[model samples]
Target chain A: MKFEIIDYKDTRSGFGEGLLELGAENPKVVALIADLTGSLKMDAFAKKYPDRFFQVGIAEANMMGMAAGLTIGGYIPFTGTFANFSTARVYDQIRQSIAYSRKNVKICASHAGITLGEDGATHQTLEDIGLMKLLPRMTVINPCDFNQTKQATKAIAKHKGPVYLRFGRPKVPNFCPPDCEFTIGKAIQMTEGKDVTIFATGHLVYPALEAARILEKEGIQAEVINIHTIKPLDADAVINSVKKTSCVVTAEEHSIYGGLGDSIAQLLSRELPTPIEYIAVNDVFGQSGKPDKLMKHYGLDAPHIAEAAKKAIQRKA
Target chain B: MPEISELQAIASQVRRDIIRMVHGAQSGHPGGSLGCADLMTALYFEIMDHDAKTFDPDAINRDLFILSNGHISPALYSSLARNEYFPVSELATFRKIHSRLQGHPATKEKLPGIRIATGSLGQGLSVSIGIAQAKKLNKDEKIVFCLMGDGELEEGQVWEAAMYAGANNVDNLVALVDYNKKQIDGSIDDVLPLGDLRKKFEAFGWSVTEMNGNDMHEVVSHLKQVKSQTHKGQAQIILMHTEMGMGVDFMMGTHHWHGVPPNDEQAEAALAQLEETLGDY
Candidate 1:
């Protein structure tokens, strides 16, 4: 149960790195940023592939529609912006043009959740996963670290449908293997235990693993699984793990109402009934704070996940 | 070129199809549909250099038209059908369940001519600009045309698109606003007046053209003139002037008919005005 923190890396940089790689590999790949190229770490891709990059200056709704239309000409368009601006701000733009039309547009959203920090509630988005996952034909991915975010970003490009890849701004623990293999709609098991299952996504995934190791010392075994791809969720993988554990805890940096917990609850309630505890922000807006402090204040850190895991295990009848 | 009378004949039939389709479905926007009949008839029939024989949804090197104001699906469906995108008989399934011609334009049904699902108002311009940019990227010499409703300008997304199209030099796109000044709620002036549309478009850096959209010859000539003006680093917009219900005598000049379907007697009366030129579906 020992692991080394490889380094701290912002997830948006991973997305930018993946976009640059995609530019070299696929000629049909094009990118559009809503005047946040530097913030999204997309300057390299924009500079390297000038012909493929479109700077749509601060107009996110237009960016979404343009991305949808790019698919009409057989081009894969990856749109970049903050999570709040990406989803809620342009929900109809994405819904009608991209999701409903089944356009091959990758909506890459960074600065997700309260981890966007000092920008306050307006900039942070805790309901984007809920917004995106409800759309039909939308693949929602929330990778844990830089490596996984980059891998997820690259993975969505090859997928011929609408995808929402959520990442963050802070440079947290980048512990995932540098060359990790990423598959869409598949859950990656970080730890195997039987007392309780901790299903986590996005930035909270790293904390779930840390919670698992801490719980091991207390003679409690927590099965930690990273449910990166939320929609078309790895239902079989989830059902299998819950069957063995018989109790579950879902963690995310999103609202407890409709993020990973809702998706997993729907999965377990229909397939196999299990007691579940949620490690997410209650229905409320975020405030200005440091990223780490925000996670602690919102009770989304490792200690919160560990406590939730224990509560879930105790609730199992 | 097809005779102007021939185009007018097709428009006459298209107007018949518009009311009949709406009357058959028991719901639809007939006013704008009838108004744009002439413009779309010319675009699909003679102006566009598109091959109607083979329908490839992903074909390049062909002029494309998108109905942004999707409630006018009747006009787009009739035009696409008569131009050989699909069977004219399918027009009967306008808003029926399991019909490809949904109330709005969509690509999910894999409808031949529709490249993107529009009608969410204010979104089509941005999408057209995307295709125009794609045409530029591929070095493909084809123009992208989008039709919008005058009332839809109230949505901020349209202006966002308008701003993007001009600033990005999306010259390969030509957008047309159906200036019937009618929406579902009421007349655009009574509801939300769009003060000086041409000036607004000009301020957004678009090369604006004002024409009588209901006139077949003006529609054709303006489309051709705009095609020549593309790629000059300025997007073009045609602020078309037409009556709310252009072809129908009783329905013109009022916003009341914007969305209301005609009853049996009214349908008969409306059909009496539009001659059955190309035969009914």
Candidate 2:
């Protein structure tokens, strides 16, 4: 693996910009905001497509219902809110009106993970991916960086059915290729190696990349894969990578239980079982801190990932 | 419009199906289904511009109905089957293994008439509002009908949907609350009293109306009158007064039968009292 330093931006901004572009491209693309247009970067979409944008006040439950209603008449509704409000706040509404009904609704959530600093534990949501993925028809995506997030937003709008597109707020290094293909249920292999497979998603991808580079210097060649789509998981791709590596290190800015780490563990346990280590938020609430400080405190930084990868590789060896 | 006698006949048949289906499964909510028989019969048999043969689940032009109180799926399944959405014999598969007739309504099994899944309370209105909004966007002049259990109103999202419909003037939608005044736990009063439901809906800025949900004539006429009420700067809510288990004498006037199915002997007695009008499914 080669060390590549690159400029980065928050994936939430990519989602917001992509939403604005989607509104301009399609007349039927309607957006509903639950008092977080600015945070979600949906202000541009709202401003450009005023007629198509609906401000559902601060009522997230109503916004969810209205979005579902908008789907009946054949409008592809995109709902914008913070990750906390979008998942736990109106989970029942999403469960019945959207997922159960199988409405073609897009739930675009920003400020995911502890990257949303200062707002503290109440605002930071680490279990949204697990919540959305459990629904039968929901398509959950946690894109790693700006380019992938932007591409995922556009791609989800084109695909029918319910989608939960989660992105973080903090600016992270964009290592993915600018013209990379965004396919749901397909993992992107960033660096291929034989000692360990480091599967990562969302903001954690940058740390996994950094950890892979650090591990390379120590003679432990790590294979890094970006698992963007949590549901409709690419089992074949995961199994193939694990077969060669024999060990797995799962990383995400989410709870170790029921998050991306849990999904990977379940997959590996079923097919080509392997020893796996998790680099994620332990079972504890995050406190107010700077983004970098929170990442380190929560054991989600690069060194933590590297250590976890080393441990997993050692277990396999 | 379907003749009053024909709708009545359909309602009676729906009642038969509800009893037989619930009896066979030995599980399901029969009270709400029997209560909404007339309303569903009128909508499927007459009002809704739907087709039985070409049952395109997502056909945009036709009117859509969402059973928010999905425990009442026996009525919905019977209505779909009798209307020829699928073979009437498929009614035997209700709640059976691998059956599309899930205990609750679902689209996962590719059920012909079900566009969205509903069993959880207070969600149908929101879904109906979504379809209604879509209809407005596409210039589709069809109405979206959503039926909710009176007890389901306890869910806060129902009120949220009510507020959105009222605030947005979601006129192309009609939601009916089966005011049977009962829930799974007990009478709505015992569980959670929703005082002055009609007043609450009125306060929410909806064009409120009331009707005997069990009466064939009133159900048809009220729905007809309320049809054009949408787009008039207010949503419509018909507070349908119904007796839980209206047709079966044994189950009426008590919350005992809200979710529990009858034993074979009890089912026979219940079915014998309610005339087998259009023939059992």
Best-fitting candidate, scored by DockQ: 1
lDDT of each residue in A1-317, candidate 1, tens digit only: 74468999999999989988999999999999999999999999989999999998889999998888787778999999999999999999999999999889999999999999998999999999999988999999999999998888889988989999999999989988889999999999988999999999999988999999889999999999999999989998999999899999999999999899999999899999999999999999999999999999999999988998889888989
Taking the tens digit of each residue's C-alpha lDDT, what string does model 2 give over B109-189? 688998877887877787787778778777788888989999999988888888888888989888999998998899999
| Each model's lDDT | 0.91, 0.87
Off by over 4 Å in 1: none
**Per-chain TM-score of chain B, candidate 2?**
0.97
DockQ of each: 0.79, 0.57
Model 2 quality (TM-score): 0.94
Report residue B150 deviation for candidate 2 (angstroms).
0.9
Query: lDDT (0-100) at residue A229 of candidate 1?
Result: 94
What's the TM-score of every candidate structure? 0.99, 0.94
Per-residue lDDT of A133 in model 2: 85
Lowest-sum lDDT 10-residue window in model 1 chain B = B51-60
